[model samples]
Target: MPNRRAALLALAAPMLALHLPLHAADAEQAPAQLTTVPGPFRADAGSLKTYQAPAWFRDAKFGIWSHWGPQSVPRAGDWYARNMYVYGSDQYKHHLAKYGHPSKFGYKDIIPLWKAEKFDPEALMALYKKAGARYFVSMGVHHDNFDLWDSRYHEWNAVKMGPRRDIVGDWRKAALKAGLRFGVSEHLGASYGWFATSHGYDQIWPMLGVAYDGADPKYESLYHRPHNQPYRNSASWYTTDKRFQQEWFNRITDLVTRYQPDLLYTDGGIPFGAVGRTLIANFYNASIANHGGKLEAVYDHKDIGSGEFIREAGVQDVERGVMEGINPLPWQTDTSIGDWFYSEGYKYKTTTEVVHMLADIVSKNGNLLLNVVQYPDGSLPPEPQQFLKEMAAWMDVNSDAIYGTRPWKIFGEGPTKAAAGHFQENTAYTAQDIRFTTKDGALYAITLGTPTGAVRIQSLGRKAGLEPRPVKAVTLLGSATPLRWEQGDDALTIQLPATLPSAISSSFRISF
Candidate 1:
């Protein structure tokens, strides 16, 4: 469980006025006021319970997220900003050799190194669209306390530093030009605590007791102001420092007000209780105005449970996780190619694994928001670009099974039992693993791998009585000829044609 969930449970109510201590010494603060835009939703739990996931988000089952930012500058994987300050850590040693010590050169100095000179949004968006991304999300703000957009509330932004370009705005334009929905992800909710490592000095001999650059008051804005707390990850991860809480609200509110994104993804759950809820209400109201008085905005809240709390307000998201079975409500699984950011020599997920994940997620009434890591200079790496090309080829023929489809009676029938939950991304599935999706008059049975001969789907068996409708035709998606098949009391068996549509994953279209 995450810190937010624990905090929510401990609250006497459903996180009403989820603010920190109001004492002057603690930095007095309260929830930011809601936007003037009138809408059906409100900050209250009762009002937000009526919130609905947007139709665009439901249909856009596959989205590509640019989880890129200055953090990619090190090419040392995720948490570089935090880990670089820790003595003897991989990123720390790398930074010490490549740049300098944290006391002299901190994360603030690394910001200016991210000059995305080669970033061509048009080309990148084209690749993503071809890779079957119906929606694209730009990193709004990450835990490094850097805003990827031109921020009015924060000076540490892309427009002023790093790329000196409006990364989020440019990505949105490219996404729209390619006829895809655009969204923004904000990881700023936990930045206050996530960045606390920067405030520390090296524990080792050469630099022991010497404060890092973040200890200086001049860099406090870049690395958040100091807090008195242990590094233990808990509900406290969401800081109780009221001023920081209000800062989170103000900056994210500015992002929503300026960007008016089709979707808004908070890295954590309804942040700062009323503060986060109010921002969500404001985002929804703005989206309604932009869409001719209709609520077409999706608020992504990370909910690993029965989607009870988040389903009341927005689309529930699971990070690097899968549901045991089909989710009753529409959900999303946000994962990355390797780490959240580009890492040196990272072994990426194979094309087959990605296809399997997509098929499985869509079958379980969920979407896959894969993070395609980017280089610091805004250019696509060769390996990930190749990965996209392969994915595009697979989607070219099987997209009909993925897009605009709903889950069937069962998610799938397989010998491999997936350990479902957060951070469990890998599952070994044989050709026997079959996933199902239904659209109109068609039922798509997608095998995780190429079936050698005859394949049996127990879930479709006559005795199992799952599929009441008689099977009229069974054909491989990329093939024109119908496959010879049988529906018996035990299972639905089908013979494979000489050629297969995709070796990565096969989708058999069953018409009844």
Candidate 2:
């Protein structure tokens, strides 16, 4: 993850590193840990080489995740860390009004309010499976310092507090029963820097002197005591503490060893030290041994200076965005219809929007992990429910074209393009865009928008001087009838039969 000023910096020159030097072409640096270790795969298992990402994740293009946790308690947006800082943001305003002033009602108080009253792991798993999720990941913990599992390392967990339930455990069980691989996300790595806001406030009385429970020693492990400044100092937010770096490494190791997560996602870069990288290597090797080397594992951290060393660290996860251009290596993009957490009056993406986005992403050799914001009580809002239903319906009709498919010569032929960078603004698509994917010699052409007449694909047609390869058959997914196609020298034309099978974007399989 880039720093707080990365966007602005990107507008100028590329952001300069404050900690390490810019990664150069001949960079000889080893990953954060275990430079001597060999990869866990059978080919490299003879020596102590670092581990590399498993093949299953690179091939299994689609997976789903349950990002919900105590943070959803307020029924607001995610960003609980940053919003809790700004004095007038919707979340900040809500926090001041409902709980008390910011100085008095810190987010720590928000913990006890999280009652996963309606949480039903089985039901949610069923819905996710119907939506075409091949694997399921649940939040093990977030930056809020709350653990969703029964943790022996940290008692400030679901079983010990608010929900008084083993949220992650139940989710794992449900995912396994549904025949989906189980994974866990740990945002704890960034808490040291991101949650520094909790230390900022006024100094007075019931409304002043008190900070969030972070300063208290009882919660130090949960909050991660940074050594750069005294616990009570106001300067803690700006200062970077090296001690917390080690703390991050230790806690993550604990998380991996106990849960043995098939997939592990760090919210940001794996902690600053080589130790964190070592833990990652250990996790991959151990998981392989535990599962007899057949069940592959994944570790999703940010793209830390790409190289053979970084690739060995784990898979890259883009949050709310995707990599630019055609990346041969597999990747995952996670986004939500509205907020990452449930909110009142939240507008969701139309079914057309989601389906088109999925088509575009899959064609680009990436998987889409769509996060739906369920209410704190575990009940999904009406809009989210409808969104999931529509997605499931689309998948029901087009699953064959999406799952287990590979990209064709081109990802798509369209004017409507999705964002190409991290944290970039999302845009809508038009009828001109067409994404392409392939499976078993079949070409899946996805129209980004609804078209009323014949569609012309220049890449599919013959030239004026010569005949193009003829399309043996053309069929719109979800429909039994075959459509007529003509191959001209310059384009392949498929005539629409007056109406589309669905209101959303439609796709057709062209067999050569």
Candidate 3:
């Protein structure tokens, strides 16, 4: 009987191994302590002030982000997970009609539905590289409390459920193979308070008194307990509870220790004050340890010139808006192609608009982290693919004007003024709108639109009051023919060829 049992156990071992996730197995085998030191950063404002943005991040001006996850499962656009619990909300209505009520089929049910079978990290990374992305950011975790990596601290992770794949690990591997810097964006800071609505039930009719699945104690780990004081608005996104703050610190620390990403982006302001500082310090210290004591990691947040911690800590990230001028410190603008997530029938930004935004942001010493929305099956729709193709063509011709360039004296000259602050309207630029960037003693003037016969740059004029520099020669970036040009006190005029270099925005390299 013992011999027969041993044979049966041996036969079942292979089947069990086959069923287990590859990343989970790898995590189990890894040494408990991988780094030489746990961390070198402290939970104080003064300790964090010593940090600075890395040069590599400054040089790598553009990055692409995979802002995807189970929230994208419904294809209803951004904030589906949170909004679905809100009674009478559009997503709530959709959930009731399609899947059932939140009382029965809540976000938990949607989690298993995200198969992500078509997700090909290598292929997608190759495409992003072709689009001229210097860096790539993957969504490590969002407000839904679902970690994308092979998380040891949390059971509700990608390896254990949902896609059942180590999404972050796979993305990092692909980015490294493609020779691009890898980064991760963590929206987990606000998870505790943001998900409070999940504990709510319908106030109307048949299911009025029934509690949502979030009220079940069995799934408490996934859907956190309702906070005594729920978040009333964005100002209260982060909870004051010490327990949630500690949890945030532990989870984010685990992420940094495990991945050692080149960049760490926080969705909101450095959260929970001291705890947030600790997380930032750990991320920085871990990055330094990984790179042999020289810090290469960049921590991005959304606080602009406000608190002492924010101003001194890391790069400021502006969401859905542009700065008025060149910031004294380096910054970034993280916007999306369309909606934050996949939304059917949503109008996306045009290729021209994207290029224009990129040029405008770069001219003001800011990086543009564009989110290219992906479908649940991990494939890009035809519209986004077309946008990428067009961007690739534009980058092929005018990438020199973008990469490794600094802002000129002025950002640009245009009638269309960009509305400042978050959620501002995007303005369309005409032919007259011009942005400037300088690289290796050469100045690049990028027109927001195609010029007619000749292009006039008033900024280069002697009388513009801006100190004039002598121009040696002028040539189009994608064209070899020397452009006919004259520099005068009034304006610097350049003759255009019968055919433009590229159909999109044109770049003229002015060598001094």
Ten consecutive residues with minimal summed lDDT in candidate 3? Answer: 1-10
Cα TM-score of candidate 1: 0.93
Off by over 4 Å in 2: 1-60, 85-89, 203-213, 216-218, 226-242, 304-312, 464-469
Which portions of model 3 miss their true places by more than 4 Å? 1-41, 304-309
All candidates in order of lDDT, best leading: 1, 3, 2
RMSD of 3: 11.6
Error of 3 at 404 (Å): 0.4
Please provide, for model 3 over 1-512, each residue's C-alpha lDDT reduced to its tens digit, 9 standing for 90 to 100: 00111232233233223322233232233222212235666667777777778888888888999999998889988878877876766777888888998878989889898889999999999889998899999999988999998898899999999899999999999999999999999988777756766776666678765778877778888878644534445555676666666677778878877888999988878877656776677778778878898889899887631122366678888888889898877888998998888988899999999899999999999999999999987889888899888888999999999999999889989788988766653888887899999999899999999889999999888789764567789999899777899988877899998888787799999987
> Where does candidate 1 have its weakest 10-residue lDDT segment?
12-21
lDDT of 1 by residue, 272-309 (tens): 77777777888888888888988999888875321124
Model 2's alpha-carbon lDDT is: 0.66
Residues 323-434 of candidate 2 have per-residue lDDT tens digits of: 6555676677777777776777777777777787677778887777777778888888888788788888878887777877887777777675567765653768887788
TM-score of each: 0.93, 0.84, 0.91
- Which candidate achieves the best lDDT against the true structure? 1
State the C-alpha lDDT per candidate. 0.81, 0.66, 0.80
